[model samples]
Target: MSEEEFRDFDEELSEGDPEEGEGEVEVVEQELTKELAGECLSLLSRTGNGLSHAYVRLDLKNRKLTDIAAIQSFVHVRYVDVSGNYLEDISPLGELPQLLTLHADNNRLATINLKELQYLQVASFAQNKLTTTEGLSQPMLDRLNLSSNQITELSGLTETQLPCLTSLDLHGNKLTSTIGIHLPSLQKLYLASNTLTKLEGLEGLRQLTTLHVRENQITTLDGFAPSMEGLQYLNLRGNAVEVLSELTKLQCLPFLRGLVLAECPLCELDEYRVEVLILLRGLERLDKDEYTEDERADAEELSKQRAEEEAPENETVEHT
Candidate 1:
């Protein structure tokens, strides 16, 4: 063969080879260029809603999204929902600094690094394969739903750090004990369907309004302290609380309104009922039932006034 023809054939063979580093570099460059074009398109598509307002919702349910590198350009995202995806790691989402809400339930995420999400408010990691709860550093977070996971310990949550958290749902886990943890602002705490045998860590939560301690092996209420003065509702139903004697200790909570002792082994309501009534003089409800005549009358009067104000003028005239 001629020398020129031999050189052309060699060139063709090199271009056809798959293991060439030059070809790999060209492919990577194409991918990066396409990604940049997509980012430009995304930016152009966004309306002038606000400066700190960028929402990206990705529902890759049951899809094989192995790498989320495309989301690197969405640094201004405020909300992201990648629930039900096959994501094993969520490190890609760390690039978004302005994220507020994240819904990543029913995935294979074992751990999350949420240190960059400083503005995140609501986070749901339910039904994931998480064994340990860590790396959540958002100070303004209000709601957290981590139910149906394999979390065995509640040691990561301390009162001094998570002061802004109001609601926490840790149901269907393996938490056996809670010690040295205080949730001061927690209003509703759901620890049902867990392995907790005692309520020890809840003594210092003065602002706890609703506590669902049902379906546990709690036999006594001795862990409760009088400092829980703002407790309004208590649900010890489905427990082994045979005697209702320690309930008098809760009398200091003058705002205690509702008490759920159903399914307990209590056969008599003799003096305990009267004691509770006398102690919590402001008790207006119990087990989803209204209070006595006076409280019900007051509530009805307020409801009637609100109804009159909300009624349409034509409806009022027709009624008159």
Candidate 2:
């Protein structure tokens, strides 16, 4: 609970026993913003021996904390969840070099700098008001979720190479292009619900497996880099791509297994499923349905029929 909520409870207790209530109220008030770290410091204060160097975890979520600068004292804290609060400045956390995972989403934080926390792995700053990823980098960072923010460019990501980074979630942002994203080892990329009209700047992510570009404004499959041959799962569910011929361009993705085009306008075509299965021969699933042997046979037969029809036209052009 917040300090305001505790004040109301303290008032009620004070009404019962004036002398006893005054002491209890003072203690609670002091503990409310104890050491300027909210409930985390309150718990540390009760430890009697002071904050231990061995303490590794601290959870002070939804405590309506305005200040957490006291976190510098807990130098050994590895995991911290300070989500859903009124925090604005988190520069104090830069001193905690042992921090690994930090969940500070859904807060009023305008900026966060964790460049010093080299051991930090998972850093989720989603649903905040961050306009840029200026000072956000770590050597061992594996997963980063900065979705639902105002990030427009990918230059922040291009500035450094996160060698160990794999999963990157940039969904629900205002990105119109992805020109310089250079994470080489990245596997899963979530760019769903953005304003991207073309798929570019992915040549560096040669190890990418899962790509989610659903709910974007992509119109064609021509811009995808050849490095996307390693892609196994692709989601272009709510795009503007209107033709089945687009699947032919993705023939290079031989490892593609699952594809989501449920709400796409191209899914309404008469030969949509069969044409997709034929073009992307390695597809094991399409639009939430598993590709069966019957479907494969039908697609193969259709492919032969189209090939036969095109043969006569080619022969006539050759003669001319």
Candidate 3:
């Protein structure tokens, strides 16, 4: 696919169905029947109190079904897997009061709004046609994965208040920037294979440890902020960062230990590794390669000599 693979339509979000293929074999839509539920429902977890029992899990994957109106009756189910289906709307699942985990990947879902599932913990809607993540408001959600979707922008994320969220994976989307996200409690964030040009609006993410913006259009570290104290890993491979001196801005990241810049323009320089090490002595690894003890000592010695040489320049300027 081309670089501008994921197309965007201004700022407006559209939930319309994707264009169908020519002469595509149509599969008849099927509803959730009691007999199918009986075959799919193998009580994975249960709790009993007198004559009452709570069902904890159900696997309804690859059922080729369209409607799942029967799950609302199974109120005790905590985990549900309805992936690989022809589901276009999953609003019926919003009626599930005790739902904890929901896997609805590889479906034809265009828009998802689980309607503030209070007890929902983990949700994955990967490989779907979701164009926006606007209405998914879960207070207790910890991990969310929306990979391989056509999501153009991240709206209503901060306004939703995901207090317990730690990991968010939006790999392979159409996002053009990181300006809309402002999650402070998030730790692991994946924005790989997007259309991002620069990184900003994420400086307040103090707890973030891993950030994957690889295969994007990022060309500079001018937006890097020192307030991001907890980030230790940043992947910037396959970007357009060319100026070797631009890496000097990376010194603001005091806690950064691993950085990936393998396919960038600066990686072609002969003194690339030594120059990067000289700038940021704290980095322990670079582009899938760990720094050896000998390389560290050499960098330290060169750094001292380089500082000494620049000392006379400062002294001359002072005298002037």
Which lDDT tens digits does candidate 2 get at residues 148-172?
A: 7778877656426466888888888
Compute the lDDT for candidate 3. 0.80
Best-fitting candidate, scored by lDDT: 3
TM-score of each: 0.69, 0.82, 0.88
Error of 3 at 209 (Å): 0.9
- For candidate 1, write residues 1-320 as lDDT tens digits: 12221111100001211222344322121122324323433222242355543334433443334456666676656566666555567776777776677887766677876564567788888877677766665677888888777888876566555668888877777778766456788877777767777778687787776677666777777667777777777776667776656666666776676776666665256543443444445665544454567655555565577678878876979999
- Tell me which of candidates 1 and 2 scores higher on lDDT: 2
* Residue pairs of candidate 2 with colliding backbone atoms: none
| Deviation of model 2 at 299, angstroms | 0.3
Q: Rate the local accuracy (lDDT) of all candidates.
A: 0.62, 0.73, 0.80
Q: lDDT of candidate 1 vs native? A: 0.62
Tens digits of per-residue lDDT, candidate 3, 1-320, equal: 12121111112122322334445658797999867876776665555333666556888998987999887777777789998888988888888888899999888888885787878999999888988877777899999988888989887677357878888998888999787777788988888888988888888787888888888898888777888877788788888999888888888888888878888898998778887898888887888677899888888898899899999999999999
The better candidate by lDDT, 1 or 3, is 3
